[model samples]
Target: MVFSNLPQQQRELPEDGTTNLWGVSRLSEVHRVPVASLRPADSPRHQSEQAEHTHLLANSAQELPPIVVHRQSMQVVDGMHRVRAAELRGQSEIRARFFDGAPEDAFALAVRANTSHGLPLSLSERTAAAVRILTTHPHWSNRAIAAVAGLSAKTVAAQRRKLGPATQTTARIGRDGRVRPANSAEGRRLAGRLILESPGASLRAIAQKAGISPGTVRDVRARLLRGEDIVPLRHRLDENGRGGLNENRQSGERRPPVARLVAAPPPAPGRDEGGVSGIFPSLCRDPSLRLTENGRRLLRMLELHTLDGQGWQSVAQSVPAHRAQIVSELALECARQWQRFASQVRERAVAPVA
Candidate 1:
């Protein structure tokens, strides 16, 4: 009674059989289908485990009319698990139904029987399902046929693509700075005329003559030269890697990042002197001190005679009585000013807390 991947026809008995439902028979008398090449409940893994408990419904239970079959055998194309479960019960017999047909037809009919309720399939899943049915069984229902054709039953839509004729069009920049396409038949005709007649004319001249932008003229002319047959030059990719006119435009190539084009803010305008005002003359003249605020301030303070206009050396010579003390005090004053300027710049750059 055990079989492997039996089509529906092999699993059925003659329709005119003397066997009666009320007649008792050993469960082993029924045919067993081999589990190979069968997926149970859309899950292959769950079918591998043997269940410990088996339940059976009494024959006396009321039920709807049985599914009738016209042929001798009905294959177990689906529901392998249900069949196994029924066999596990200790009862000698189980309620069953049968269909009669060629093994292949029965297998296909079994699949179409819809014995189990399940979730709706996704688009990609439906496509795959359709492919399988079309490849394996062509005699199934239209539902199966369409599924194999990758049609969405709900939407009645197919993924097969259509390519239309390519056309020429003026490509102008819109007021918003994006590319604009021309549409009028007269306009496209005029553009095509100008292109075929004036071979040496630049895009700007062609656009001017056609009352469109130079960019648009260029686009239309290019498409025409490439021998596209449509009025509004549209580009789609075909299987052979050539341009095609289709409902959807070919995917555009990607561009690089925008951050690379910018230079780094000219190193923050190079604090004129050692600070914002450039009052520190020494720091202002030092090229190496441009990026570093601290270095600039140091150079500026050390050259304090130029910054204040009251020459430090001259002042010390004028009062020779404490020349050494005067130089030391002047140097200290310069250091203090530099610190104050540096702090002011830092404070301005740092944002205030909310």
Candidate 2:
């Protein structure tokens, strides 16, 4: 299974103020779903790959992975070509995994899945997919969008530019699932003052207050202690993208790698309030959820994967290096499953229990 380009930490995001601990699966295990019952997926590829279909048709059914299906609409999310191949094989029932997510996200998932394995999406197809993502998620950083589209951040930036100023944003969500100001002189300045005001304050505390990373805060403190400028010498391009220093150097969008300096962090994507954990209690209390089997099932599903920040660290510490790869794969699979469930649930809000 493949996770989306966005970090799993922000799973089922841009809408649900929640990070997915886990999600309710419509079908807990792969089963034989009727071929006639499933719908054509909203694929990222321009068209079905005829060669891939032919290849799949030649393979034994046991050799192929189960096709992914949309629980609500019965649409395929990642395996339309497989579906075609199954149909050509004269199979009435095909093995399938269920994905419950919005139509748009389903498309993104399809792109990422296709990119991760199976036949490759052509360069043009990937470019088109990247453009669509930039349009829909204008606030997502180029790297985040590029991960899904399987393109370089540079290419993603170029596509964003072609989208014109209207689609350009002042802030963007980075690859690590952080929302940050495009330019960060203000944050650096603020960090410098915070360090001076409370010399004993922890780096995390200062970083949180200034909306910059702890790494950035540490650097700022180091500079202030030296009685030098808080801004890195390379970033002397300043707030206006020019002028304070280094006129001869490149000041364009792509700059040398340095600890990230963010302007100010924004609220979690599609949210103005608390993040996933913050909303967990309210969801637990909702009658529409607690009072019904469907809702309770979703809740229970979440409980199985519950791991807080410290819990994650403890688990990571305990895992043996020899088994780390298998653990990582399992962890990703869990995330992918929950992400699908969470997206679909959000798309429908609460399906009335009848």
Candidate 3:
């Protein structure tokens, strides 16, 4: 699997700060470093004589992946077994790859590399490594911790619970290794602005431009269409910068009342005899089950036109497609509703009384 957020290009770092060099170009060169000069950062989690060692020994006649080393401390991060296997072949120096980072970061990389490849880490080793990671990267979420430590999120959560709460972190590392802030308020605001500017823009396009979820963008568009204020509420301030509820105290004027559409109470239980009830009887009986506000408004408009004596043929001919497409879509929707109602009825009929 590809590791996210790891630097793939070679770059220099300040003398005091750490630098990460990745890619096969950096790790491709197999430097022959003296075995005696190399030191293991931590004890081997798995026995070197396991199947991996045997396989390495069997392939000792050929080339193998270079061992990973820390350039700063000369500590071996991975491939202890390969180093030993090479030594058994009477080799003084072994091929190696180098990574330059803090010891802690190197250790974390080591744990991840070892667990993800070749021989797996033992349970105790994995637990210890997870604990160390939690202590070092306390802001990481349970899933993030688990991803790097080779454990389940539940296991990481349990470990965290045992250690109690830690400082909450708003930044999270994604699978691609990029760090992103969890907050999306700015994104939502941008989406709202875009929706207001381009009312006909597709939700997917708006979501992509705003870098927010499509669902959130859809909700913003719906609210805008409903005439709901998307702007957040702010405290009103006077000319002197004093905040108060009474705006008239400073401006000496009252703001006009904003017009809003409120749903007329679903006509009391049995009162819809002549209107919508004559049509969708089930929906009229159940106020909770009805079309969206826009749909209801359209339906009400049609009812008023019919009351004004406009025949169905006149209405159908007035539309561009001659109402064929509209009628087909409505019929399909009715069929789906009927199918669902039938299924529910059958289930209730067969259900045991309880």
Best by TM-score: 2
Clashing residue pair totals per candidate (backbone < 3 A): 23, 1, 4
Report the lDDT of model 3 for residue 138. Answer: 67
> Sorted on TM-score, highest at the top, how do the candidates line up?
2, 3, 1
lDDT of 2: 0.67
User: Total clashes, candidate 2?
Assistant: 1
**Candidate 3 error regions (>4 Å):** 1-28, 43-60, 182-354
Provide the lDDT at 294 for model 1.
67
State the lDDT of candidate 3 residue by residue for 59-89, as single tens digits. 5444555678888889888776666666666
The reply for model 1, stretches above 4 Å from the true place, is: 1-74, 115-129, 137-151, 154-354
Query: Which lDDT values do the candidates have, in the order given?
Result: 0.39, 0.67, 0.58
Against the true structure, candidate 1 has what lDDT? 0.39
Q: For each candidate, give its TM-score against the true structure.
A: 0.25, 0.55, 0.49
| Clash list (residue pairs), candidate 3 | 4-176, 4-177, 5-176, 5-177
Candidate 3 C-alpha error for residue 61, in Å: 3.6
